[model samples]
Target: MALSRYDGCGETKLDCVSPGGVCFDPRFVGGDGVTFYFHGRKDQDFCLVSDTNLHINAHFIGKRNPNLKRDFTWVQSLGIMFDNHKILVGAQKTSKWNDNVDHVVMSFDNTTISLPPNEGSKWNSLVMPSVTVTRTSNTNGVMVEVANNFKVIATVVPITAEDSRVHNYNITDEDCFAHLEIGFKFYNLTDIVDGVLGQTYRRDYVSKTKVNVPMPVMGGQQRFSTSSIFATDCSASRFGLNTNRRDGVAEYPILHCSSGMKGSGVVCKK
Candidate 1:
């Protein structure tokens, strides 16, 4: 979502305008589908997707602009932490956007998936489950999703604007950048879940973490990077479990905790 300022009277004040006199600010603008606008060069992390089963953080690359007296930022990479696996997917540096080449790289649990840039490339495992890389209909973006589920996990779309060029800001290179949009939907998720971003489908849920980190750098070089480290402390609440029996009697199985209990296993509770 685009960031905007409110006056003392609680009215939004116009910040920047495009060459066509269009007021431009960080905002989530649209009806059916919306685009989030973010300013860059903050050494902070934004948790775009946070659920009991999934945690995705968007690291924005930001640089300062003395002429504009503001920081211009773009999403550099996404840090996805799910189950017991951690993956990082990001675009390589480029001077302009290319529709043919896939500059994205995905690292699964410290092992990089070495595959040529093509459609229908898939990655699967017990820890991270299934991930498929495919080209968008317009061939201008990349769509990463869960295999056979038809649910999009993440996306990279090209940024188009006359003022969006690298020369307009204090970036280290003259390459253009793209925006990152993510939607996290895990399989077999229960209602009672806890996360930093809260439940994905809950209307009243709000993100508990901050999206922007304000770190002033001279040029437009990335200030910080995310590691492969991740944690899966998620546990479904037992209160949501069905324990009522027709005969008015219920039984609960004793849980056996072992060193490897953190891994996948089915628990039988009667």
Candidate 2:
């Protein structure tokens, strides 16, 4: 390593290239998997040039033409992982209007936030949910990053008894309430080291948290849309070398409520 002086500061050897760029006044920024603003001339005051060309992070640059399918245009899922040197990005198909990529511009060995959950509290519970993150250090591997606010929709069947003599001989006037909450405590990928489990594995983090999502109320017992949070079995487990067999079970976590009259003991199907 050689020490190079910058702006009069004593020369300091660098172990790694940080986010922006390194020496030679690069008119382009090409770290973290995405290259932006590159000038054709290499030495002619690279950093000072204006109107530089920006390239897409991966091969999906330019207009959508031949290779990628139309579904790729609407990236529904996105994830960023930081490991040894490269940044890994994962994008899925979406039906949203943004036709752009849901997952883009991720770097290896860098700790970036995961994708947001499906549909939940867009402001409080869903946006920017945090998860325990881990990424593969190798080149072009599955990137695993911490994702917060991961949520899934489940069906809740209301077990109600029909009677004509409960309140008004036909129907009641009081509004029934059912408190529902769902959560999952997933182990951090960083805890597994050299096949040994670390103490941090015991700590569980809430990937997603949802509150009374106001299920539609109808006559007697009815079917309602309930929001829940649980650990999902991701298929990318083999890439990052996972340990500690924790079943990514999405079946039962625990359902709780405040009042118990409009509904009874709730049972989840699939």
Best by lDDT: 1
Where does the lowest 10-residue lDDT sum fall in candidate 2?
47-56
lDDT of each: 0.39, 0.20
Candidate 1 to truth, TM: 0.50
What's model 2's overall lDDT? 0.20
Off by over 4 Å in 2: 1-79, 90-208, 214-270
Q: How well does model 1 score by local distance difference test?
A: 0.39
Backbone clashes in each candidate structure, one number apiece?
A: 9, 11
lDDT of 1 by residue, 1-270 (tens): 111123352111211210000112222211111122334345455543444445655566555667775666665566766556667777566766776656666677788865545443444555545765544322323445554222333345455555556346433336555545443323333333332222322334343323232221222122212232232322311212333222201101121221112211112221
Question: Candidate 1, which segments miss by more than 4 Å at Cα?
Answer: 1-41, 67-70, 126-142, 146-173, 178-200, 206-270
lDDT of 2 by residue, 140-247 (tens): 112222342122111111112242233212222331111111111222223221100011122242111121322211111011111111111121112245345433
Highest TM-score scorer = 1
